[model samples]
Target: MGVVYIGDRAVGKTHLALELTSPQGNYVRVFLANQNYQNLRANLLNLDGTTKPTQTIEKRSLNVEVRLPIGISKIAVDWIDSPGELFRRSWQSEHINEWENFKEMVGKSEGIFLIVPPYREILQPHIESENYVTQQQWCNRFNRWAEFFIYDCSQARRIVICLHKADLINCEIEQEISKLNYLPHGSPLNWLQRHNYVVNNYFQPVKSELEKINKSRSGLSVRCFITSIYYRSLLELPWIYLASYL
Candidate 1:
């Protein structure tokens, strides 16, 4: 199944891309093209500094295969490094060719990953400031974006909302997990519990919107992940569960 990664500019998308290209313990990334992975790594750093700004193109796509995964023979990934402007400018307003390409990506995607970074840094500021857009406004806009993507890609059975830079969050989720008595209060909660809380709090609304948009879409599965290419590696995580499906 092909999977696409969607997020605004500089939210660890390229970092995640490069990490999988390394000699992974669980899997290996096979680039369909002959482009050197080393050059792409350097390009990531330059991209971040505006030295090489991402162009407003349809996509910077790479046909890749994460081969010999734990539970599967191979996982083919048609990964695209998309422009932040597509979502920022609301491309559907004009129904441009780029927007059509986006539609094609969503239409063909079996799984989707939406990367969300810390609000204060990538999105809006945590506190109100003079000549700055309100945090609530930014939130509303993001929510709309999520709803729109989910609607357009409603048929995608598996969706991953990746919360990037988890260390930067203002209200630590671990602290909030304390107040809830229903979920088994334990020292060092497992991934399932954390994922459930995070998804319910953030992704449920978007899932609901998706259902509303396409009432007939069935067996939809959306997962929330606290993903960091730095703090932790996804390769170590039991992706065999996901690989089995592929």
Candidate 2:
């Protein structure tokens, strides 16, 4: 199966990929075998705060064996990590071939991991700056991505809307979940309900837009998750969800 992780510049998509495919990384427990990530690890091993953004797309192949209700099934995953800027509209004109290649990859892929960061800190009070992207701007960007999938990648079966970098908003979310009068048994929907604030505050606009789009043309199985590399279990939830499809 083909899969891709899409996100904005500096939003941690590469970091998340590095951690997922790392042998010594926290997510090692989720994978039965991930020996082919050596090349990917070598390329990203020197990543740090000063690391430049990915300029070209990179692919990592793995035979992921996961337990299903039927039995053990091995899923061959061609995981693609692309340059964030390449997905933006502005870059489409500048990098024509790379941009088309990305769309083609998405069209052939079975799943997409849309990695998005928390917005609270992003929307915090700050001086007006050219680099600043407001919530509306984000919604616009995400909306465009949704349209791309709808029109360009109709073969995609699953869409994982990941609220990544959750470590940054974990405490506040826990407090909000604690205040809830009723909490259901564990599940993705229940988890979303428990962390309603994260949805309502951070992802509502995109969620609403997605709903509207889905109503018109439906087929995509959408799932949401609050992920963080700092929390191993949390980091693995999205992958587990993806595995369920297998």
The numbered model that scores best in TM-score is 2
lDDT of every model, 2 decimals: 0.54, 0.62
Q: After superposition, how far is residue 119 of candidate 1 from its true place, in Å?
A: 1.5
Q: lDDT value for candidate 2? A: 0.62
Off by over 4 Å in 1: 24-32, 47-51, 58-73, 88-95, 121-138, 170-194, 200-216, 234-241
Give per-residue CA lDDT, model 2, range 78-137, as digits (tens): 656666676566888887887788778778888777877666444324423344456677
Q: Show pairs that collide, candidate 1.
A: none
List the candidate 2 regions with Cα displacement exceeding 4 Å: 22-42, 45-51, 62-73, 87-90, 120-132, 170-198
